[model samples]
Target: MPLTILQKAKKLFDQKKYSQVISLLEPNILQYRESFQFYLYLGLSCLHTGDAGGASSYFQRARQIKMRDPDLLTAQAALFLRRGETDQAVEYYLDALEYDPDHALAKKALQFIRKKGDKETFLNMAETGKITAFYPKPRRTSLHPAAVAAPLAVFILCASIFGIKAVSLSVGQETRADLSSISLQAIDLKNSVEAGGSYRYILTEKQVVQAFENSQRYFQSYRDNQAQVEINRILNSNASIAVRTKARLLMEYLSEPGFDTLKDNFSYATVIQDAYLYQDCWIRWKGMAANVSAPDDRFGFNFLVGYDTRSALEGIVPVSFDKPVFLDPSRPFELLAKIRIENGSLSLLGGGIYQSVSP
Candidate 1:
């Protein structure tokens, strides 16, 4: 007898094997189309695997099957939050709260997004335990008697000779110089900040790079809010245009509905590796068309596409169009298509194809 879908999924989920869960459910989704549990499992699995669109679709299906399920509502809210849809997430979280007021995860997540105050709190939350844990505590050491006595004697001598106003002016000038030095240091450090009672530190370039890398990882892992914070850091920092452009593109991909999900300019490797995760996602790719086939009676036109003219027939993506179009195998072409994976190979399902303006 075949193992029940939920039972098998629960076992995989317990093992933290989310991809296996997705593989198990996807092929059987049509068979258990009406099962709320099936959709819920599939949605959670997709969310874990960083397939936000897939998770959203499955969650919506589950919600349609059973709207009042608090878990489903919370999961949907999380998906919305990960996609940077804060208002939608807030509404869904509120709906979930209405169903289950004491939902701890929803309450915590809501508080996390809503609370706004203090650089320390923001940094602490953004870096989690990493920053605070690495920060050394102030050492409890006593000042020497000679050090105290020397300062006290100097203060008395200066007060007797210069009077109060002269001493005050001298101290003020020194204080101004100290402040100026700090201001200069802040600028020189690029990404340094004063935190907690005169303590100052600069984040090294490596740290900044690591932070951005973490943000990308979080985004791919369906941790959108965390990813957004890091992306915003890159956007607001003195980072190079290349880094900022990548962050902006990622933000647009997550936040803009008009943007196509399949076509990511930053990470082509990710798209290739996780093609199945983005099945049905639309992309606009510019390449050279080759091996063009005549329009079939039923299926339409087909061709193989390569990234450039030199490799026009090598490592090509199989593409299909609904109608016959003019093709120039030598010149570059552009395609706007929905992606599909068939029998472990990538293909374009259907969309427009045209000649490219650039070579």
Candidate 2:
């Protein structure tokens, strides 16, 4: 009878009858507790049926056994994002991208984030009249008086038109890049956040797990690309593929949540706290010397979280000072965490409700 039920459920799941599959599997997942496949399929079914919380719980159990499957992580990420946990969604996208760059869903999501960010920036600039500040200046001197007058005027007009277009294009490109980078970095901050015990958000635990999984994928890809680059150098071969691959990997990581660069003795620590929620933090030492002209970075420092405000840390090593910042709990949503990187060290510090405190 159990086998018959599973067979029928599988048939329904294959037929895109997610609701039917969930109806059959949900009870079994709760009863059997031993069938990982049941949980996995149940999660998928719930996901397709638009049950975010249910899908997350089922996926968490499935993830315990199939930890390396990016598909599971990606599915969970989608649930988090759908639930408005943007930070977690960004993290899973990164993890999925790292493992499989050809993942169309993740690529599309990243593109969406970049486009949205650009639109917002453009709107802000328009609202603030920042775009109107740069006024055109006429040419000061022209070669030859009469002969240059007509031609010079024409040339100047053409140059003005070209310059304006170029400037607009440049700004658009830069804005899009910045938005993508910022979003990815924010997710990183979310993951680095230490869960103050309970998950506060709708899909907090699922998002956190996804973030960690994504970080693992990113680091692995980063190291692999680095290795390939080194091999190319040693072989004196064309390093284009290796360089491109590495750059692409970096871009994907930046698109995900919680991407950071930190300074240190030998090198900067490039850390990822968690890829999905962007909370778990890591640091790579960046061997940048202290600004000798300004007071040494030995005592006071400036700390920044993602692309947000820079808070001044007094009489202490700001890079090392990481604490959870609570978000307002009155609303239906919750903030996941805050990621801060200062000095030459990178770390993912925790804050927010959508987090996990290990048992």
Candidate 3:
């Protein structure tokens, strides 16, 4: 019997005949439309032939068919790294780890790159020197007199200030009491702001300004959860509209991809807390579709989402899709979406929803 197209492709692929694999697979892709393995093999074949675009399309189709496939994620990450897209490569690698933390290849690749540092550093080292058994001696340099004196001056200044402040505080009971009162007041003000209190009524202008400054410091340090809490407090407090708007914008900026180091996959609560921050950023969220709306004239759809099927629809989030989405209320779904916050309401703008496989 003559070998089938898929069998021939597989045989050629295993024999390292990548071009032959492509020739066999390309024309027969439609015939194997439901075969993820076919697309995956074709993608790998294209990758070996240096046809990155073709490989990417094939890989993407495979991903759409099975989004959580760790092998596919790792393959895509490798492709991204080859293309010099380090950030995207890292993202995909991290995502693969999310699915399978023990994935040895992804783990090893991430470790190697992280230790090697950036590509430029690696290239520079490679171009500047050749490997040899014998190596040249290093040049030595002496520290400048100014560099030595600078640290001495700073040390003396800091010591003097510390001594003066310590003496002033030790001088009187009244001064100690006053300082304690002030410290307590400052703590109270901070707690009030973090708890979503109206700082205008309880704190002076200087205290309010200090609280805002402290919150900004938290934001800069990647403490986004704390920053969002403070921002929420400011929004609900009796702050000026200008201050509130600035707070909203700051919250939105902090929710961007590179801002938070701790979270790769943001929760729905995270999105709801600062929807504006996640705007234009991709998110992976899971929820059950409660009420799926018909597609509008623009082919957009809206749906109310519950965290799970058994949950009540009230207080549920409204998710808008710029394109129609096929939803089944019985099955829980996950979506990789771009967030949109309009008129203080959060919605998903446009992205495909992935239905969970039936158990």
Candidate 4:
């Protein structure tokens, strides 16, 4: 029944109550640390209040979190304009157009800049109310000046870094055989906009950054298991697909530790305490097989860990194997199996076994 901070902020911003917007959002910065919209709103308010330093700081923070936002770009352009940085303003507007060609503020700004971007003329225009036309309203999310970049533009952007074989051709001998021709290859520019405007807003951009950094640190420490947990956190999070894919790829060089070489060889008791922690970890457990069912290649049994010593039974864990092994219920064996936490139950997936009894 209550409006959230963002909803209240949006209402205040739309009403042109820029000071109130700043007042409402500044204190709650911690709550919305990862929120791009929050920073964007704050930046817009700061710019309007004539605090260029504050606006620049908020805008820079917003850009670090999400660079492709058109509204943020347009506001940044406005900030550059107020700071008397026409060149930078033009660049920001152009950058905004690249992401959103139909951006109204960017288009108007670019057009106005082209006509009156000169120092004295721009200053004269600023004296009048005409310059206000280029400023963007936070509520109005719209884009239209330059068309979306075609495959040709794509080739141009990539020309300096490396030659895209499919999109490049050598020109007539002009010293270094200047790459002149851009391939006519069609590149479908991805206009990715989420259909539903509502979002759950799970992990903040800051959290994602911290998690990724922690994972890299863990990886550098050679604690691949801990590193893997952090990596999986990012992979399984509600972060962007590109970010998740990047997280998945960051540990491509990670080497899985063997059961024998594992730094933390968790005991049955330790595993029993927290199965999820030891998940996927392989441990050599000593036990005897019970209810042995070996049919051809598949083997299934209940491993009675620590039952070898008739003094006490640690736990009975269900185990299964795809390899053929003539297991005897009467004889004791040491099982090296990977821990699996399935449906809140702990189980062992058999990898190998050392038999005390003859095979």
Give the number of the best model, judged by TM-score. Answer: 3
- Candidate 2, overall lDDT? 0.40
Clashes of 3: 1
Model 1: CA > 4 A from native:
116-359
lDDT string for model 3 (1-359, tens) is 99988778877877879899998889886688766677777887876776766766677667666665556777777565654455666656655555555556656666655665376643443344321101111112211111212233333333343231312322211011111212224443444333344443444445555556655765555555556556655554555555555566665445333211334455666667656545544566556665566544222334444455546542355566543344456677765566666787876664556664342
- Candidates in order have lDDT scores of 0.53, 0.40, 0.54, 0.64
Angstrom error of the Cα, residue 244, model 2: value is 36
Instruction: Tell me the spans in candidate 3 whose CA falls farther than 4 Å from its real position.
Output: 97-102, 121-278, 281-336, 339-359
Report, for all candidates in order, the number of backbone clashes. Answer: 0, 44, 1, 4
Quote each prediction's TM-score: 0.34, 0.34, 0.43, 0.41
**Residue 265 lDDT in model 4?**
58
The reply for model 2, stretches above 4 Å from the true place, is 1-4, 30-36, 116-359
lDDT of 1 by residue, 153-233 (tens): 333432343232321233211101111211213332354322233212234465556656776665555444456656656
**Sequence-dependent TM-score of model 3:** 0.43
> Where is model 1 poorest over a 10-residue stretch in terms of lDDT?
172-181
Model 3, position 111, has a per-residue lDDT of: 60
Model 4 spans with C-alpha error above 4 angstroms: 124-130, 139-359
Q: Which candidate leads in lDDT? A: 4
lDDT score for candidate 3 against the true structure: 0.54
Residues 104-167 of candidate 4: C-alpha lDDT, one tens digit per residue: 7776776666666776665555566455566677644423233335234433433332332432
| Model 4 clash tally, residue pairs | 4
